[model samples]
Target: MNTIEIKKISKVFGSKTALNNINMSIKQGELFGLIGADGAGKSTLFDILVTLSAATSGSASVHGFDVEKDAKNIRRIVGYMPGRFSLYQDLTVYENLNFFASIFGGTIEDNYHLIKDIYEHIAPFKERPAGKLSGGMKQKLALCCALVHQPKVLFLDEPTTGVDPVSRKEFWGMLKRLQEKGITILVSTPYMDEAVLCERIALIQEGEIMAIDTPVAIIKSFTHPLYSVKSKKLYQLLKDLRNFKETYSCYAFGQTVHLALKNQDTTAIIIQDYLHGLGHENIEIKSIDAGIEDCFMELMKKTAE
Candidate 1:
């Protein structure tokens, strides 16, 4: 069963359109991700679905209840965690968790199993104020509160941003555990590396979804053979490559410039000569697989045209 549905949902703030003709359905027990950069309207969509804001037009529903007509029932069955920490900083960890649980007319012991995995990790910090805990501990506490009432649908906006690498990994691992519990999760993150963790992902840019599919399928759909070029003078190489007449598009990815060409006939030797002609030394170009971020950049180029 689909736990969340967005149909032609459009939201505009003053003169700027935040979301336009966005449509998606999230299945029960599925981990769906909204992938986008900043200002891509991820948070705006979250607010609409969570009933914090109303869409200018169109509609959305959670667990088959209309967001506009049955907001009270919808909110009861949904748990929302905003991108920023919204917990009371002065409250101790246990206090914050229990307080949220009580707000939903439930006790911690009533839904302990639902949050046991995440709560156990922070139980030792139960006495510490939320502001004093580590980033990961704070994250667990936020999740525990969100799940305290055992909502059928969960909406998380950038839940792992600003955390350390290990903590980010742990956060995603926790999400995987949540998915197994029959809860539908709609999460948005600016981190491309996390896209692969979702069952399906929607790549959004400027309020438009450019692509929607599994991570492997999206990466595989990337056409045009790509080449990664590296050199000691990385910046110079990037500048010279974009100047090449045959270069279709080129963007810096890590230490290399991922380049797509207009003519597949251009040999590596010709590319070498052109770089040498431009006085670039130690240039290296090799055919390699495209990553999720690479595919995202390519899709953005397609959308621009």
Candidate 2:
């Protein structure tokens, strides 16, 4: 069953359009991701779905409850962790968790099973003020509070953004465990690497969904003959490659420039020779598989055209 459904949703603020005719459906027990850069209307769409804000047009529902008319019911079944750290800074970790559970008319003991795995990490710091904890600790506390009510659906807006690498890995592990317990998760992130972790992802740009598919399917859909090229002068190489007649798209990927060829028959040696002729020393080029970020870039380029 689709735990969440959106139909032609749009949100406008004065002259600017935050969301444009967006439509998406998330299945129960699915770990879905909304992947996009900041200000791509991710937060706006989340706000509308969580009933914190209304869409300018169209409609949305959560667990069969209309966001507008059944907000109270929807709120009861869904847990929302906004992009920002919203727990009371002055409150102790234990206090914040207690408060959220009480607001839902439940106590820590009543739903301890639901949050035990996460709560144990912060249990040692239960008496510490929320603001005094590390970034990762704060995140765990917020997550425990969100789960304390035994919510069926979870909405995490960039939940891993400011945390350390170790914490981020640990957090995703926690999410996997939650999914095992049958909690539907809809997470948004600008990190392309994290997109692959989701069962399915919707790539959104400028308030519009560019593509929605499993990570592997999206990568397989990339039809371009892509090659990664590296040279002594990286910046100049990018500029020269962009101006190359055979280059379909050229963008920097870490230390190498990922160049999509206009022709499938183009060889890596051909690219290396071209760069070498342009006075580029130590030129290296090799064919590479397209990743989620590559697919996203291609989708964005096509959308612009």
Candidate 3:
């Protein structure tokens, strides 16, 4: 069963269009991701789905409850962790968890089984003020509070942002455990690497969904021949490659530049010769598989055209 449904949802604030005709359906127990950079309308869509804000047009529902008409019921079944840290800064970790549980007329003990795995990490620092904890600890506390009511669906807006690498990995591990327990998770992140962790992902750009599919499927859709090129002079290599007549797209990727060609027959030697003629030494070019970022870039470029 689909736990959440959004149809032609659009949100406009004066001249700014925060969301543009968005449509999505998330299945029960599925781990879904909304991948986009900041200001890409991720948070706006989340607010609408969580009933914290209304769409200017179209409609959305959570677990068959209309967002506008059945907000109370939706709120009871959905757990939301906004992009920002929203727990009371002055409250102790234990107190915050207790308070959130009580808001639903329940105590932490009543739903402790739902969040036991996550709560164990913060249990050692239960008396510490929320604001005094580390970034990762704060995140865990917020998640425990969200789950304390035994919510069936979870909405996490950039939950891993600003956290350490170890913490991020541990958090994703926690999410995997939650999914195993049958919680439908819809998480948004600006990090492309994290997109692959989701079972399925929707790539959002400028308030519009560019693509929705499994990470591998999306990568498979990128049919262009791609090459990774590196030279002694990295910056100049990027600029020259972008200016090449046969170059379809050229962008810096870490230590190398990813080059897509207008003609699939273009050879590495041809590219290397071109760079060598321009005084680029130690040129290395090789065919490479397209990743999620590559697919996203191609989609954005196509959308622009």
Clash pairs, candidate 3, are none
- At residue 54, candidate 1 shows an lDDT of 96
Off by over 4 Å in 2: none
Candidate closer to the true structure by lDDT (higher is better), 2 or 3: 3
By lDDT, is 1 or 2 better?
Answer: 2
lDDT of each: 0.91, 0.93, 0.94
For each candidate in turn, the TM-score is 0.95, 0.97, 0.98
What are the per-residue Cα lDDT tens digits for candidate 1 across 1-305? 47888999999989999899999988888899999999999999999999999999999888899999999998899988998899999999999988999999999999999999888899988999999988778888999999999999999999998899898998899899988988889999999999999999999999999989999999999887788988889899989999999898899988989988777797778888999898887889898788889889989998888
By lDDT, who's the top model here? 3
Which regions in candidate 3 have their CA more than 4 angstroms from the true location?
A: none
Order of models, best TM-score first: 3, 2, 1
lDDT (10s digit) by residue, model 2, range 1-305: 58999999999999999899999999999999999999999999999999999999999999999999999999999999999999999999989998999999999999898789998998999999999998899889889988999999999999999777888999999999999999999999999999999999999999999999899999999989999999999999999999888999999999999999998878887787888889999888888999999999999999999
Error of 1 at 103 (Å): 1.5
- Per-residue lDDT of 1-305 in model 3, one digit per residue for the tens? 47999999999999999999999999999999999999999999999999999999999999999999999999999999999999999999999999999999899999898899998998999999999999999999999988999899999999999887889999999999999999999999998999999999999999999999999999999978999999998999999998888899999999999999998888998898889889998888999999999999999999999
How many backbone clashes does every candidate have? 0, 0, 0
